[model samples]
Target: MEILKKSQSGSFESSDIIILIEPVEPNSGRNIDIDSSVMLEYGDTIKALITSKLDSYNISDIHLIAKDKGALELTINARLETAIKRACNIQKATMH
Candidate 1:
């Protein structure tokens, strides 16, 4: 999905991450900027995870910033997914 405007999700709580996203020109490509409290070792892993998720959603040509506050992989994934969906105006599915 193409991101239409700036959008964000998550909180600054102890074990959460905040994701900010904005649409960019298609030719500009995807740019991911990550600031993590545990960048010493897990930086690449975190970046890879984010990239994979974006790819899974077929999202390119966007600027994404993830601010991590010692969150786990699951938390990061959820936040990023929420932010992307919001930016793309994709509604969450409801269960019967």
Candidate 2:
């Protein structure tokens, strides 16, 4: 999915992360910028997770900024997924 504009999700609260996605020129490839409290240890892991999620949705050619406030892997994944879905205008299914 092509990201048409800037989209964001999550918050700066403790144990949370904020994700920002912006559209970039096609063929430029995906660029991810991360600011994490635990960058010294988990930076690569976080980037990998984000990359995997984006790839799952076939998203590329965009710029992603992730601000992490000491969140766990699961939290990061959830927030990133939400932000991607929002950017792609994909509606989440509701269970009855």
Candidate 3:
């Protein structure tokens, strides 16, 4: 399931994260840009978490822009999933 359009979730509020998702051309691969207060400590981990979620959905052609406000792993997972679902016009939580 590839992202169909630009979609976003979360906010810039403290302890939260804002995620923006957009579709990319087929075979262009996935691109994720992350900006976070904890980048120095958790950059690679965040990217891996995001990549794992995307892989779970079999999504490869997309671009993600994420600005984190010191959010936890669970929060990041939730916001990212929400943004992806929104981009794909999905209503339920049947993530797959």
Model 3 ranges with Cα > 4 A deviation: 93-96
Would you list the rank order by TM-score, best first? Answer: 3, 1, 2
lDDT of 2 by residue, 1-96 (tens): 888778788899999999999889999999999999999999999989998998898997889999998899999998998888777777478321
- Which 10 residues in a row give candidate 3 its minimum summed lDDT? 87-96
Error of 2 at 33 (Å): 0.3
Full-model lDDT for every candidate: 0.88, 0.88, 0.90
Which pairs of residues collide in candidate 1?
none
Q: Which ten residues in a row have the lowest lDDT in candidate 2?
A: 87-96
Off by over 4 Å in 1: 93-96
Poorly placed runs, candidate 2 (over 4 Å): 93-96
Error of 1 at 52 (Å): 0.4
Global CA lDDT computed for model 2: 0.88
> CA RMSD for every model?
2.8, 2.6, 3.0
- TM-scores for candidates 1 onward, in order: 0.91, 0.91, 0.92
